[model samples]
Target: MAQLSDDCFAFGGDLMPVHAALDLLRSRVAPVTAAETVPLADALGRVLAEDVVAPFDVPPHDNSAVDGYAVFFDDLQADGETVLPVTGRVAAGHLLGREGRRGEAVRIFTGAPMPAGFDTVLMQEDCRPIKDANDGDSVAIPAGIKRGANRRKAGEDVTRGSVVLATGRRLRPEDVGLAASLGRKELSVRRPLRAAVFSTGDEVREPGQELPQGCIYDANRFALIAALRQLGCAVTDLGILPDRLEAITEALERAAAEHDVLITSGGMSTGEEDHVKAAVEALGALHFWRLAIKPGRPVALGQVRDAVFVGLPGNPVAVMVTFLRIARPILLRLMGAEESEPRLFPVKAAFAYKKKAGRREYVRARLARGEDGALTAVKHPRDGAGVLSSLVESDGLVELPEDLSRLEPGMTVEFLPLSEVR
Candidate 1:
């Protein structure tokens, strides 16, 4: 376990910016568990543990691209129709040997192996039967067809001994299909991170329960759990904990002993009954950093024994934003994942917006094609962190930099697709 400085534990001030908070969290945490072998069918979304090299060519041999006639290119005379006996036929999964002599042709179907001694393929439409012509039991091949024009060369798709997939890549359906093409039934992948999630505050109730006055159902837990699952984590739900120090501490202790990381919402701010922060410090150490971002300003990060602690804000929208901007990266790193920057696309803003300088803000926006055939982002009507509905209606978030205070309509801004972040 890594220790934090006393200054890092300070709370209740100007929060660190989102980027700065991420840097600190990543710097202190390391991967908890590693290496596991999983069947290719079950490996989707898992991080690769090693590089995959192709042991054989993709197509494996020269084959016909279409149902056509495989012929010797030199046997055809210039502008003169020549008849050749179709001695053999080749279909997919069947091969014809090198028994064909000079001036011969073989009837071949699509995906069939090209017979030996044949260098070119003429389409079936281009050739006519000998019975209709002056020749007997033979076909007429036209001139001007290049040699080997329609024959698929061996290893054209993937060469032997070539590195097909690199280590640390998250396996997608296409990647799995590619691996299957190379005859791999299993893959080495990193073990999924075990995440324990909970919510704190007696005012938080389960959805089915009757809501007392001044109480709300806990939505952050579901959001956190879903986000963790999206990142390929095995999640353990700890439910909601009261504001009591003992109950919170007991949950933290159990979680630290079992999970790679422990996460919670609420009870982190500097207010009465905020026992999460205090309990975390008493159990191990708690570091609260101020993020210079709108909607999600205060984020608590620390270590509890062996488990990394991530305390998200109580607001539903804030929980989602902070989880994506802060915890997602650290979780990836802890899973031994290779770091790749989020894909950001440049888009023009459709409306004007105002914000203070020195604080970065992510605005939920719907993207549309402008009249100029370019992508334009229109800001959502609501910017409050509690407005979870905004995220449901938007495609992604438009990033406003820390130095810029105002954005005018038609101004260029960076758009980060939510799909890319997950």
Candidate 2:
């Protein structure tokens, strides 16, 4: 089993800053070293454990880009229209047996390897057919048809011996298609990380269950499970655990022994009912972090046996926000991905708001084309961490860094799409 560094992460001084805590967490994790070969069908979202090197040049040889006539550029009449005798036909998988003569052209289709001695192709639309006595059929080509036009050169897309996909990359659809284009039947990827997700509040009931007075539906667990599935983890849904300390403790211990990671929500707060932190501390080492961030002001990271524990808060919005801000990167690292940080794009803010210094905040916002034609982030009206509707209504989070306390309209800020995390 992969393990984090023996020395615990640093958090003794003041409350850990967001970036500092993230760095410490990632630095301590050692990506899983195990690897297995899987067919391309099952490779999506799997981290590559080996660099995919192209054994041969893509296209294998120069080929036609369209159905047209292939000719030597030098053979074309530069001053005016040039007529050439049609020699033979070539389709995607078919090639002419012999090289073309200077005064002749090969009728070629898309993806057909360029016949020897031919370096240019003219689309069928650009050439007119002409009758010929000796050659039987010929083509009238216009002048100024540049050399190498309408042809895909061998190795243009991918060169031989080049590393096409590097190790630690999570395979996307395009990446899988690329491997197929290079004739790769299978890929070496890291084993999928196993995770268990559950809730621990007696007040949190399933959606279909008859709602008792003062009881709410458990929404965070389902969302967390979905996100884990999207990240390619084999998730074991533990459902809602009983609120008893002994029950939660036993569940945590069992999950720790079985899964690589244990993710639980609603028990990291300071309330007396919170039992996740206590259970984790009793079973293993737990580090509670007061990260300088809004929505998610507190988070807990710990290890139980060989499994990592990510304790998330209860508020629906806070759960999603904290998961994206902290748990996402740590889980990615545990999955053997070297680059776990989500992509953030810069856009202008459309609203004004005052913020406190020394805390990073994620404002729910949607992008719109302003009257000036520039992309701007329109803030959702509500900023409450409990308002899960804001997360659903907005496209992403507009991250306000920890330095500036004031944000005026048109100020540029980093926007992280919800898609980035899942």
RMSD of each: 5.5, 6.2
The lDDT leader among the candidates is 2
- Worst 10-residue lDDT window, candidate 1: 4-13
Which 10-residue span in candidate 2 carries the lowest summed lDDT? 4-13
lDDT, residue 332, candidate 1: 83
lDDT of each: 0.85, 0.88
Model 1 CA RMSD to the hidden true structure, in angstroms: 5.5
After TM-score superposition, the amount by which residue 146's alpha carbon in candidate 1 deviates from its true location, in angstroms, is 4.9
Which stretches of model 1 miss by more than 4 angstroms? 1-14, 72-85, 99-102, 123-147
Compute each candidate's TM-score over C-alphas: 0.89, 0.94
Clashing pairs counted in every model: 5, 0
Per-residue lDDT of model 2, residues 1-422, tens digit only? 95555422222345667888798887676775479999998899999999999999997999999999999999988889998889799999887988878888989999999888899999999999988676499999999888889989999899999999999999999999999999999999999898999998989999899999999999999989988998999899999997778999999899988898999888876668888888888899875555777777658788877889898888889899989889989899999996899999999999998876877888999989989998899999998878999999999999999898999998899999887777
lDDT of 1 by residue, 65-147 (tens): 99888898889887877688887789999878665578788898999988767888889999986764644467888778887
Q: How close is candidate 2 to the true structure, as a TM-score?
A: 0.94
Cα shift from native, residue 88, model 2 (Å): 1.1
